[model samples]
Structures are given as C-alpha cells and as structure tokens.
Target: MELAISIIVGFMILGAIYAIHARDILSAVIAGGIVGYSLVICFLLLKAPDLAIVQIVVETITLIIMVAVVLDSSRVEAYGKFDRPAWVTAGTAVLILAILFWFLKEASAPLAPFGENSMRMADAYVNGAVEKTGSINLVTGVVFDFRGYDTLGEATVLVTAVLGVLTILRIKGKR
Candidate 1:
C-alpha cells in the first residue's frame, strides 16, 4: 500500500510537471486531467473510495471546461527553448514542488474520525430539541437547528461570490 501510494504520488508530480511544461493549452489541460486521474488512484489506494469517485467526476467536468475554453480562444502558439530561460522555470517549479511536498508531509498526521462526534452530536440534538424544533431527521435537525444561521450565512457568501464572478465576466455593451 505504501509503495502504491508513493508511485501514485510520483505520477501526480510528473503529471504536474508535464502540465506546466506543455506548450499548447490543450496539452496542458490534458496533463491536468492526467494529474487528476492519478490523484483519484491515490485516493482509492488510501481507502477513500467516495473521494476518488467525486474527484474523477469533478476532474472530467473541469477537463471538458478547459477544452471548451481552449477551443474558443483558438490562438495557439508554440515557443522555442529559453522563452524566459530554462533555469528560471526549472528553479520555480522545484521551489513550488518542494513547498507543496513539505505541506503535504506535514499535514498527513493521523487524525481521529468524525463519526463519533457526529453520532454524539446527533443524539444530543435529537433528544434535547426534538419537540421544540419538530425535526425528525437527525442530520437535518442538527444542521437546520444548531447550525442553521451559519449555513444561511455561508449560502449568502456563496451567492455573493457567484454574483461577483458573473459581474466581473459579464459583457457590458458588446464584445
């Protein structure tokens, strides 16, 4: 299992390098897709089947969107060696990868599962406020009762972000 994870991680790193070094936008996008696929494999090997499925689906959508954007632009150009000096690109890539590898290594410490907390919290909410809130579903009850206001605030923030993005990208008069 450890060896498999190491191999997957290697593939992910190589794919990321390929994506960065790819000249064409479409090729870079394809490299990104490969990276995502490799990540899915890593997730599966780590016993996260659900996350693997979700990542695969999201990666497919992202790849399609990137392809569509590239097609729309259609101004592909290839550069010869030393566009900004190969040493600079190589140094920057190594720096970024080193930082990322450090973060990942530091963050992978063993953590407790959330199921115990969820179950306890659900029990408390159900028994304590069952009649007050008139909610039966434990999960919904906890969210809509205990964290209802927070969820509403989060939704508002999300809506604002979407609106901001749309406004920034909107064509005012014409292209």
Candidate 2:
C-alpha cells in the first residue's frame, strides 16, 4: 500500500512538473487535470471516500471549464527568461525539497491505524448524531445538522463556478 501511494505521489509530482514546463497551454491544462485526478486517488487511498468523491466531481468540472477556456483563447507559447542563476534556483529547490521531506517524516503519522475508527469526532457523531439531531440516519444528521454551513459553502462555490463558466461562454459567443 505504501509503495502504491509512493508511486501515485511520484506520478502527481511528474504531472505538476509537466504542467509547469509544458509549452502548450492545452498540454499544461491536461497535465494539471492529471494532477488533480491523482489527488483524488490519494484521498481515496487515505480512506476519505467523501473527499475523494468531491474532488473527482470538482476536478472533472474544472477540467472541462479549463479546456473550454483554452480552446477559446490564443495558443501563443510565452517563455520567460530566468534572471536568477541556475545554481541559485537549484539550491532553493533542493532546500525546499529537504524541508518538505523533513516535515513529511515528522508529520506522516497516521491519525488512526488502517481500517480503525479512532477519531473522537467520529465516535461522537456516531453516538449522538441521531439523538441530538433527531435523524435516523447518522450520516445525514452529521452532514445536514452538524455541518450544514460547510456543505452550503461547498454548494455555493460550485454554483459560483458554474455561473462564471456560463458568463465566460456567453461572452465568447458574442465575439
């Protein structure tokens, strides 16, 4: 499982690098989509099914919108010359990598062992959600009663994104 996760992380890093270094806007957008999907896979591997589902849906919508935008825009490749020395950039990147490695080493402890439910919040919700929220379905009670605002915020963001895409498409049609 660890090896699989490592391979996924490697692919994600490769996707990010491809996105950043891609000469064509369409290629970069596709690479970015790959990275986003890789993140969804990572969430699933971590046993967060809800997060994985949300990420997959959001990523799909975002990728579609981005592809539309890319198709509508000019495809000029702009390469900016770096002012800083290559060694300086390399050193900075290495330092950042080292910091990330150290942080991951220290903070990589699992919140709970694999397949174990050890979260206090989970326990609380499982035990009290029905009683407090008066809902027979604990998941529904927790989502609608306990975290309704958070869900609303997510819905609002999705609606806003759709509106933005519609507005952009309308402007493009006018041209």
Using all chains and alpha carbons, the TM-scores for the candidates as numbered come to 0.58, 0.67
Which predicted model would earn the best lDDT?
A: 2
List, residue by residue over 59-171, the lDDT tens digit for candidate 2.
Answer: 99989988998999976688887899999999999999999999988786866655576777877778766669998867578778889999999999999999997998678
Deviation (Å) of 11 in candidate 1: 0.7
State model 2's lDDT: 0.86
Provide the global lDDT of candidate 1 against the true structure.
0.80
